[model samples]
Target: MDGKVIFIGGGPGDPELLTLKAYNVIKKADVIIYAGSLVNRDVLNCAKNDSIIKNSASMNLDEILDLMEKSVKNGKLVARVHTGDPAIYGAIGEQIEGLKEKKISFEIIPGVSSFFAAAAALETELTLPEVSQTVIITRPEGRTPKPSAEAISKLAKHQATMCIFLGVQMIEDVVNDLLTHYKPETPAAVVQKASWPDEKIVKGTLNNISNKVHEAGITKTAMIVVGDVLDTEGITPSKLYDKEFTHEYRKGQLN
Candidate 1:
């Protein structure tokens, strides 16, 4: 009996935000390994009563791989779950590499990322025509160094909407770096544990966001959104929805 591993994105702390495929896989998994610190425990409700569940929070890469390898050899279907989309900051690349080296079969299922959830919670669009055409998803340089070309200050030069991950703990530095390019009054917002029941949102300008976040006591598990898109006062509506615009799906009404 050949076994396999499925990497499921748990979707930003909201169990409902999980993809249907992920839910099904969790339900059918013979063994489930999840990121206990970040993933919502409620998601475990989908698993069988007798399923073997392990929390990877305290486990290192080798220990995790050992568990996966042992489970696979025993012909058990394993579900390796991570918070938000596995592709983003979930640190699954190392795990995937280990699996490949061991000749283990695996598949990655996508899920709703925290940034999108944070955007939805704020009821703001990350991109608005003529305002911002690009969204930069990045984090401040911490223990893990970022490429010089992708540094926050460098990226801020475009003044594009930025959704920063793993930087809330360094909000002051993040704000300072962003200020190098963005204006002092540039709109910024932080959403902590987006989509969770007790989620918190703090909105302010680049000059004051750090203070606001500090007041709110948001140290981690937060997304920092910056740019003019948060300004709902003067945004231009998308042309795609304009009644006069023509496209492959619609003909121009005015000509």
Candidate 2:
């Protein structure tokens, strides 16, 4: 029988956020490979006692491929666990292509991304009428390859609420780039490890975001959320809250 590889999104360092299906699949996995730096150890505890667990934090692409190939060769179901959705910058495409060369079957299991968690943690809606109907998620290009057009300043031109990931280190550059489009007083917030215990939120505008982040001593594992959506007092109520906004889902007032 051909063995299979399961790509599991471990969620934002919180075990409770894991889907029941993911938990079940993990419990039955014969070989589990996880991103040691980000994934919580509590997630690994779900594996069976006899299961083989390995951390991919220090491993190179060849090493990771070798491990998976060896495990599958032994007829063990391998689980490749990632911090969030494996599709976004997870670097799984290369691995999948390698697996294809070896004829290995694989399944991808999506999980709750940090952006959604950040929004929920802040109790702030990403989309609000006239403020911003769209949310853009991107990062400042550094070691990672990004199209020139996708530069932070370019994306900032949209002036839409943005969830910036893996770019805290470049906050100064981020601030400068965003200032080209966003006002210095545009509201922004930095959420460190959303939904996780000890998560921190630092609120400020574009002009002071870096300073606030510096004072908070936050360097990584955080996301930067920017836009007027953070302006709770200045914005009008949602149409759903309007007295005359009738809808089939909920009853509206006649007066």
Candidate 3:
């Protein structure tokens, strides 16, 4: 029917992790543009045999928008694929703005983020009632200018569960910033290539995480998680499931 551009989240590096909707969009699209290195080859293989596939990494924003505009105008379906969830660090904002200027129709399909995948790889709950109920997702500022309020050091003061992205390459700096508020013995973990066959996990306190990660040679594609939740030393059950806890679904039970 009419032409449209659908942005799909490839979900980490596992092809099977692709949402059913994402897989279906890839199967029916006439053109596919995926982020190179970020997306797994197996996920790209879901595209129809005749689908025109292009690596977005090799092209600039103008080139990418040009392709979508041309394809949509020609009444062809274009699937713009990104690694993990398109919302988190997917870099799709500029492309979306471009599509708007050209008046192109587009839809976004959500995918599993690497941070959640990292959580799954560790088999740990991100939120614990008494330990830390807040999970702060952040990154260390690099070439990208981070706002003062979102600075790593400032965010560290909360001492809540923290998942750091794109900072493994400069983990020492990250740890240094974190140490501004977090204790040296605070639990920390690094999960590299989560959900991939070559995934690696490193668990340690803040005092040793940087060295452990460096020794493990994890320079990229890793998720750094910190907080008391990872320790699991004396985690207690949540109020949600407590026998004496009352809610809309169930009445409180008394001893």
Candidate 4:
């Protein structure tokens, strides 16, 4: 098709986090479909004043796709804006499939995901040597039931740093299931609306994080991070920066 559509990741509630490509696309878009409830409204300001903007929060997949199809058929540039990286639970698969069926050309411009923003806000790394060399990103089973193998109870057994998304409403159940594999004192934290102006963070252990989150009243729009990396009291420095470690870029001091 001659008409094109662009899927832009708006990042996690921070207009400044938007990529240059996404910003430019929004500015040039003839039609913009934004996830209003989750994306920061400030990013919408980038769109041309005459652009046709619609909130997809209340719109179903068919409705949204219809809008895009109509706009594209009229030879207009349609921009589908999603919060955070669209690849991560952005539900763009169905939309892409629909676009393909209609033979519409499209491009995806990725943005910063909430998990990375949460990590930045907490000043914590997901992977730490000798602590947690792996990071797992998943969510608790809800209306969308995950495979039994991907269940929290089973994933927790790895003891890797985990970033739980869209599970704040089920924080208690999440913590309880995590306790099955993590120690009571394993450092855990919850970041609400990361990168937003009024963002909130609750830090505690497996035994107390639920209460803390409950007291904070963060029912949604939060990310749960669990691992020893949160306990940044005395982590070993990475070998990459170690003077004694050798690499192609530098000689080992020990040698």
Clashes of 3: 0
The residue pairs found clashing in candidate 4 are none
How much lDDT does each candidate structure score?
0.94, 0.88, 0.93, 0.93
Q: Write the per-residue lDDT of candidate 2 for residues 1-255, one digit (tens) a residue.
A: 367899998888778898787888899999999999878888777899999899999999899888898888888999899987777768899999998898888999998788888888888999988889999999888888899999989999999999999988778888998999999999989999887888999999998999999999999989999999988777777888788788878778888
User: For residues 2-87, what per-residue lDDT tens digits would candidate 4 score against the true structure?
Assistant: 56899999999989999999999999999999999999989988788899999999999999989988888889999999999999
Global CA lDDT of candidate 4, please? 0.93
Best candidate (score: lDDT): 1
Q: Please provide TM-scores, in order, for all candidate models, with all chains considered together.
A: 0.98, 0.94, 0.98, 0.98
Question: Cα miss at 97, model 3 (Å)?
Answer: 0.7
What would you estimate as the lDDT of candidate 3? 0.93
- Give the alpha carbon lDDT tens digit for every residue of 52-141 in model 1: 999999999999999999999999999999999999999999999999999999999998999999999999988899999899999999
Worst 10 residues of 3 by lDDT: 40-49
Per-prediction RMSD in angstroms? Answer: 1.0, 1.7, 1.0, 1.0
Give the runs in model 4 whose Cα sits over 4 Å from its true position. Answer: none
Q: lDDT at 37 for candidate 3? A: 77
Give the distance in Å from residue 229's predicted Cα in candidate 1 to where it truly belongs: 0.4
Residue-wise C-alpha lDDT for candidate 3, range 64-121, written one tens digit per residue? 9999999999999999999999999999899999999999999999999999999999
TM-score between model 1 and native: 0.98
How many backbone clashes are present in model 2? 0
